[model samples]
Target: MSSYLLILLLYVFDQAFGESQLKLVTVLYRHGDRSPVRAYPTDPYQESAWPQGFGQLTQEGMRQHFELGQFLRKRYTGFLSEPYTRYEIAVRSTDFDRTLMSAESNLAGLYPPNGTQVFYPGLNWQPIPIHTVPQDEERLLSFPLSNCPNYIRLMNETEKTAIFLNMTKTYGDFLEMVRNKTGLESTSIESIWSIHDTLFCEEKHGMTPPDWVTPEVMSTLQLLKNFGFQIMFGVYKREEKSRLQGGLLLDQIIRNFSAAASVNPSGPLKMIMYSAHDTTIVALQEALHVFNGVQPPYASCHIFELHQDNESFSVEMFYRNDSSVAEPYPLTLPGCAQRCPLQDFIRLTRSVIPTDWDKECTVNTHSSDTDVIIGLAVCGCVLLLLVMLLFIVLCRQSEPSIGYSHVINQSDDHS
Candidate 1:
């Protein structure tokens, strides 16, 4: 009897302790390093200098993503199938060549060909579909979306803040220096960063730095560049800005998690991966209140993991910033446990998540009024044109018909 009791106890303990299971995972990663999108007017290396020109991925970029893929494969060893399965995972990327190519490179490491799946002999790669919408239509992975008038207004207001003013005053000399050095016509905060970006990329690739680009200058430029990024997404009205920018992505991720935990779950997409820009990652992080305030490095990845135990579900987040690190750092949402309950996660993030993105994007009364006024003016112009056309037709009808008058004269002459 005691033996049977012991067996029952053991079974119960095992059931209680081992019941937790990982259900779903979502990952958003920035594309790896690339050539500069543009060079300074005086830059020796112009568009023609790069092998594939500006804005394309480099060889190092492909390797970074491939290694990241391998890391994913190891991390989800048993959870994901050994062989590539279309139903098990879905990948999405921005329409840009670098992001799209990064997704392809990542998949190559994640899903190597196995067991009769080899299309080309000795080649481990098999074509996996990486989906994307047109760039203009992309809302989920794009940052600082153009359609949001409220965001634009917020940015304009942010520029007027004392912090921005102070920054401009502080960096006025540096900005002017860069303009003179680069031979560029304009040297706004936004444009000056491109010069730093070009210099940084060139230095990374072992090219000699220009004589004017001293270490002190580069450091100052980096600081300004980071400041520019902060103001773009986080300096003013960060939460509201997130509602229009990163919140869209967070809302979608939350929805995916909730759907996976539903009683009636949909198809078998266990993992969803997003290949995007650093801004996309920063935006989402800011929305989650986890932004570190620095620019995300190349190939940085943010992971959202879902876990289920008994009748309860929870969410966990991790950030992998460095490839050499043995493990990703855990991120805890404020006001919640490390493994936050799904309900709590949703509730905490509800404010940032927009109910109607388009409606929220047009929240500015001034913009709405302007739109209304413009619409009314256009309608008035169209109405006036229609009325003028009608008046011309009426005048023509009222006039003595010329053809009829000619016919009458001829008849009279004949008589």
Candidate 2:
């Protein structure tokens, strides 16, 4: 009886705890650093300011991502099939020159094509496809400064919120004080957004920033930049949330691999790479409940690793900030079971998964003329009731002669 009881207990534990194993992986990351795409007036880094010219990757940025790719290759060496099958990995990038080049450089280090695929006979390097959508169609990937009416209303409402009221006032005061202290016209808000772009360009080429930008000032600006990210992701207008924080495309990519892995059970995409902008990484991480409120440094990667035990699956999260560092910073998915089950993981992700922005979900294109006719029928009934009430009131006012006739009949009967 004791043995039977023990077996029953073990089964119950298994059911409660989940299978604890599954193998599938998905990763999303911003592209490595590059020069300023455009320069504003009073900026130090302008066109012709860098060695490689504007909107090009810096040497340091290249090395950072190359190291990241190498780290990924080492991390999944045994798990991935040899020779890096096309079906085994996918890399995508935003359609900027810097991002495209960053993707290429990252691939150079990640899968450096080898063996039969090397057509050059001696060299292993080969071109890999990095998919991208045009900038205008990139509403999902980019945090557009929405000029919509509802969004403006939300922003105004945010200003009235206590947190925003305090922060904006303090930051505005800081900007005013800085202008007075430095004798510069640039406000803190403008400097904060464009500083990284400025210094990146100056450092890339052989230019120098003016003495007004102290190291402390730069640090403050960086913090403000992070604040901006937090506002954009968590504090933005309600209607624009899906378009801004949506990660459905990324989730779909993972689901596709998980499906393949379920059927084949041996080989699926071991790694997926996204070389995009800082905003791209920030948007996705926020949706995933892992945002750090700052622009991810050059080559910063959010890694999603999967494991399997028997029939069940689990996923682990890791963030690597520095490429030179070997270990990834461990992170947990919020509201996940310990060793979260694959199906549960999908469910949690679905809560934050963005709906299709281009397709108006509220629109009923099929219900047109017939629906309008039905609406008019309902309106007609209301109109008829109102008209009947008016007619009754007019008839009562016009019937005093009928009351007189009744009185006359009563008098005739008495006589």
Candidate 3:
């Protein structure tokens, strides 16, 4: 009777407190600091740009991501096998130069391959593969390319959303006021994007900004620029939804691991790392139902911890702001992830795969109103005939007048 009572008590406690065994982690973070992508009409940074020029990482960014990598190394040291097993870890970066370079710099801090077991001195690095796809082929990294026609149409609609409309009016008024005060006619989303680039460049190259711009004014402008990005990328539902699509991929990655775990305890993929953009982290948080208002700062990582119990498997979330820090904020995954079975985690995220906007865009709304397919076939036939006639006419123009006589002679010879 006592043994039965003890077993019942243990089972109840396990069910209530929820003990989890975390074996693997996959992290996604944004690139470090970078130069402005482009310049505005009234911008401080121009074509001549900074010392190193535009769209490049700064020294400060290098330090930031390096520190982040070091933090990961320390935090997972015990969980990871000794001597840093290459197969146990993987890193991927977006193909942009800044991001690719940032991953390299960050890897130096994270791995630091040399300490005691080395024949060479002054070397503390190992080559870690950072996979990437072309920026044009980078839907998995950046959410919803603005160039996509459907996404552009949605952005137009998003601007009309009450939240976005109000912001547009507010920013318009603010820009007008700024122009009135500074006598500069350049201030818009297109302009604000370059404010940081200008400041970073001017300081780096030792060029002074125009007299109309003061340090305080530039700071305000910078804040406003970031705010605009937040509104456009975060507050806007259409953009956010597109972002969520990118995050859905990460969720799929996690679910795959969980399925693998269900079958084997210590098979493969003990840890995974994704060196990505701030938007990657933000989009993922939003998908997990825990997005903060501000974009995730540089090197900010979202960690997914998966565990399995006797009865079921579960997942926990953690966010680390500083790489040096050991503690991370506990995050909640919405719907089934809060407390879910492994099979359920797999089932739920499968629904999140984004519907391709290109396919959606190509859907003809007018097809139902007419026999458009038949009409298109008829039109195509007519167009082909017209093309054939034009080709014959052009050929005749290029041919000599003796062509008919030659054909008749050949036919007589054959007879």
- Measured by lDDT, the strongest candidate is 1
Scored against the true structure, residue 279 in model 3 reaches a CA lDDT of 65
lDDT of 1 by residue, 165-247 (tens): 99899999989998999999978776667888899999999888889999999999999988887877787898899999999
Q: Which ranges of candidate 2 are over 4 A from the true structure?
A: 1-22, 121-124, 144-156, 176-191, 200-206, 235-244, 261-268, 355-415
lDDT of 3: 0.66
Q: 1-415 in candidate 3: lDDT tens per residue? A: 9999999999999877666666678777777877666655666456675556677787877888888777777877777765656777777777887788888887777777655644467666767788888888876667545555544555566667786566567678666656665446666653564555556456654667677567776776766766655544455663345433554555556655655576555466667777777667666665555776554766677887667675566666788876556687777655654555666655555544455545544324466336777888899999999999999999989987864463357767889
lDDT of 1: 0.91
lDDT of 2 by residue, 1-415 (tens): 9999999999998976755433556667677777776665656445876677777887777877777777877887776665757877777777788788888777778877776778797685778888888976665455533533333445556657776667767778767655665446675442556655666456545676677667776777677778766665566553244343445454565566467448565445556677777777776677666777767887888877777766566777888887657798887777885456667777777765545433433234356667998999999999999999999999988875644343358767889
Which candidate achieves the best TM-score against the true structure? 1
Q: Could you tell me every candidate's TM-score relative to the true structure?
A: 0.86, 0.73, 0.72
User: After superposition on all CA atoms, how large is the RMSD of candidate 1?
Assistant: 7.7
Error of 2 at 7 (Å): 18
Q: How far in Å is the alpha carbon of 364 misplaced in model 2?
A: 16
